[model samples]
Target chain A: MKEKEQMKNKTGYIMLLIVLGLYGILYFVHAGKTLQALEATFGVFKTVAPILLVVFFLMAFLNTFIDEKSVAKHLGDDSGFKGWFIALFGGVLSHGPGYIWYPMLQELRKKGALDGLIVAFLYARSIKLPWLPLMISYFGLTFTVVLTFYVLVGAFVQGIFAGKIMNEAKKDR
Target chain B: MPRNVQRLKETSLQTFKTLQSIAPMLFAVMGLVGIFETFVTPEMIHKIFNAHAIHDMLLATTAGAVSVGQPFLSYIIGGELLDEGISMYAVTAFILSFVTLGIIQIPLEFSIFGARFTIVRNLLSFLFAIVIAYMTTLSTSFLSGYFS
Candidate 1:
């Protein structure tokens, strides 16, 4: 696991180095364009820095308070409406990179959490709480609100479809 | 230390770690975005998206599905795309699929979930992203008009 994490970090570093290297080469070939790109990059970082700080802090808070066991506990097969609620909101509140949650979700499925709810959880993750402010800042409140509403609706719809399809496949098997 | 204080400390440490881990990719994305801003013209983007709602949504969905990133990064990219005169439909679809549909994570998802489940979920997400994009933009415009 540690090796895998190290590999991931290495990949990120390599990608950064490549981008930086591109800029370095561009500096000799097209210094003006390279400077312009650097300025644009700085502009983007400046625009996002405050919001990113809030997002990071919120992520940390969520991490400290919400443990995987508790999330898993509510997503069981018989969890019903409450399970759906937990799945939807839990997805919104989920932090960190999405891949990290996959293993825990896989474990949850093994323990009998419905595939529908799992699908819902994954879909609802698109509506991230930490990033809501940033989204609102870009897209405005109305667009953000409407988009979030539809995303939750889409989550449930997709969840139902996945659940039904998986069940039918199981029966056929 | 008190329990609240201990929690705060842990949270702060986690925040630092997350920021550290994400920094490299974040800078890389920013640099790429800078290059995109400097070189990628509106004419180039328009050629791909073309402002026709359906066409833009489809292209946006395709672009977003193949792209991988954190949700926050999508907002930045989406915002920039919007600044470049990409339609709201395209940007919306792009943002949705960028987070929800992970073509890159297919192997991981397949290994964890069965093939049927992974395929079904991704296909559904891809379609729904377009639907939600249209719904979101239409609803926002309507609400804006009503309020005004």
Candidate 2:
């Protein structure tokens, strides 16, 4: 168990090294653009940092004050259709890079949230209402409507498929 | 005061631990995505979708899978691609792939979730993205034909 965790912790640093190595090659290929890429990296970091801090604070607050019992009671394994609705609503409401949501989802799962609902939630993030009007304006009403419908439907389908697969995989482990 | 202070300390410690776990992955993802944005400019996006062959949908899909950004931006990009005379099939695949697949973020994803779950979910999403895009093309042409 200890070795497993140490290996897990090393993964991020290894990935970082590989990315930097690519950037090194990119520097030789395009010196000016490589500088811009470094700036963009900082920009991405700035955009994500505050939001991630918020999530971390929320996690701490919940860990300290809110018991998992309450969250689990509603979104737990038997949460059914209602749980799906909750998850979708939450996802649609969510904003920012999807990576930030993964840790939050893991927290939700530990609180007994259904696997399917979590997957559905991630898929639903595609339909941001603020952008819906923009999408329609660009893609037109009919195309927007059809695409949005498929996205919503796709979320549920993705959810069910992910849920079952993840569960079965876990059981095998 | 002592008990409350201890409780506060524990929560602070927990939050720090959370930040520790998150910070590395966050930085790694940001670094790669920054490079992607720098090199894969809109001009490049236009170039990537050049082929009009029916099978070129896969090429468009591959581009989409690699690129990551706001879903709304993809619509605007898709519109621009449409205006560029790219085939509907390729455009649709690009839009769907933009939202669903995340080749760039796979490392971060795998770090949080296990390998099996991450691979399976992404593979399923990639397949669905293709199917959804294909259906959109088929239906849109059918609608245009019927209406006209």
Candidate 3:
């Protein structure tokens, strides 16, 4: 366990180093663009930071109030359509970078959450509820509605495919 | 009261640890997206979508799958593409791909989900984006035509 934790930290540091290296390269080669990029990064950070907070709070709440058994009961391998239907909403409500949700998902995995439901959640994330007004403004109401519906369907398809393929791969092992 | 406080501490600690674990990669990803944003202006994207040829759907979808941006921006871009006379297929595919696939964020995704799940999920998403885009255009236009 100690070794695995160390490995994870090592990977994280390496990735951070890579990002800093790229930033350095940008600074030297294209200083103006680099500044603009940094500015852009700041913009993203401003938007993402709050979402991250919410996600963390949600995770903590899950840990504190919700037990693993309940999670498994709802979204487990045998969770059926009801589980999947709830997962779509759960996923959409949870926002931020996909990585932000990884730890939570990892927790759920330990509790036996279905990979299919997870896939559906992530896929459906493309169409955020808050962003709908803007989407409708640009694509018109009809297109936005249709596309959102398709996205939901696509997420389901993705979940099913991931579940089947991952299951098969597991069996092969 | 003491027990509640202790539980709160543990929860906060766990959330902090989770954030610490992924913060590096997350920062790196944002930095990269920032740089990409500097070069890949919306104007450039606007110029790229007039191909309207037989393989335009693939072209649009591939482009969308590659480029990474916020969903809101993609919606606006989709609107611009429509104004530029780009076909609905390309526009829809582009928007779908833009939201669903992340060529730049693949490393982050791969790290979190592992190689097999990441690859399969992304590939399936790419294909589905195209299919959905086509279906979306067909349905919207077909419905209006039928109703009209």
Q: List TM-score (chain A only) for every prediction.
A: 0.58, 0.88, 0.90
Candidates in order, TM-scores: namely 0.64, 0.89, 0.92
Model 1 clash pairs are none
User: What is the Å distance of residue B50 in model 1 from its true position?
Assistant: 2.4
User: Candidate 2 or 3, higher DockQ?
Assistant: 3
Candidate of highest DockQ: 3
lDDT for model 1: 0.77
What would the per-residue lDDT of candidate 2 be over residues A1-173, giving only the tens digit for each residue? 56655665688778878888888999999999999999988988888888887777777766666667866777877777788888888888887788887887777777777777777787787677788888778866666677777878888888888889878877897
For candidate 2, the TM-score of chain A alone relative to the native chain A: 0.88
| Candidate 3 residue runs with Cα over 4 Å from true position | B1-5
Q: Write the per-residue lDDT of candidate 1 for residues A76-118, one digit (tens) a residue.
A: 6557789999889878987654554654565467656788998
Give me the candidate number with maximum TM-score: 3
Better of 1 and 3 by lDDT: 3
The local distance difference test score of each candidate is: 0.77, 0.78, 0.80
**Ranking of predictions according to TM-score:** 3, 2, 1
lDDT tens readout by residue for model 3, A68-99: 78888889866787898887877777676665
Q: Lowest summed lDDT over 10 consecutive residues: which window, candidate 3 chain A? A: A1-10
* Real contacts recovered, all predictions: 0.78, 0.59, 0.69
